[model samples]
Target: MAERYEYLPHHLLRRRVRDVASGAEGELMAVVNENVSDTVVEHWVELAYIRGSSGREFSTSVDNIEPAVAI
Candidate 1:
């Protein structure tokens, strides 16, 4: 049988990533797995950044984020 969900690779954690659709950039904080049904699972990623003195966070599908290019 095929797998229901694929977890993000460990090496990707704490790495910089960019949201493909939004162009937002931040550090990859975590991977979350949600079971939608007996046979269905969804993979998500938490991206975070500090703006001034506060920290901000957002979650999106793992597929929507990619390693950020350093300039």
Candidate 2:
């Protein structure tokens, strides 16, 4: 079977992001999207400060987010 998204709602995860312009380096709260096609699953998170320009939210594959064991 294919991999599953283990992180649940309220779960936290650390995403490996770039260190360039507007790069994010910190823990992010996970918000799983239940409305997805059967073939795919995903979640939305806000790492970069949500504001003008960075107003758009980010969508990441469930596979990319790992459980935040500490902090």
TM-score of each: 0.58, 0.29
Superposed by TM-score, candidate 1 places the C-alpha of residue 32 at a distance from the truth, in angstroms, of 0.4
1-71, model 2: which lDDT tens digit per residue?
33333335543444433223334333453545443335445533323211123544455544444432334
Model 2 spans with C-alpha error above 4 angstroms: 1-7, 13-29, 38-53, 66-71
Q: Give the TM-score of candidate 2.
A: 0.29
lDDT of 1 by residue, 1-71 (tens): 34444454545678888877677787877775534354445443333331211257776667787788999
Local distance difference test, per candidate?
A: 0.60, 0.39
Worst 10 residues of 1 by lDDT: 45-54
TM-score of 1: 0.58
Which stretches in model 1 have alpha-carbon errors above 4 Å?
A: 1-9, 35-54
lDDT of 2 at 24: 32
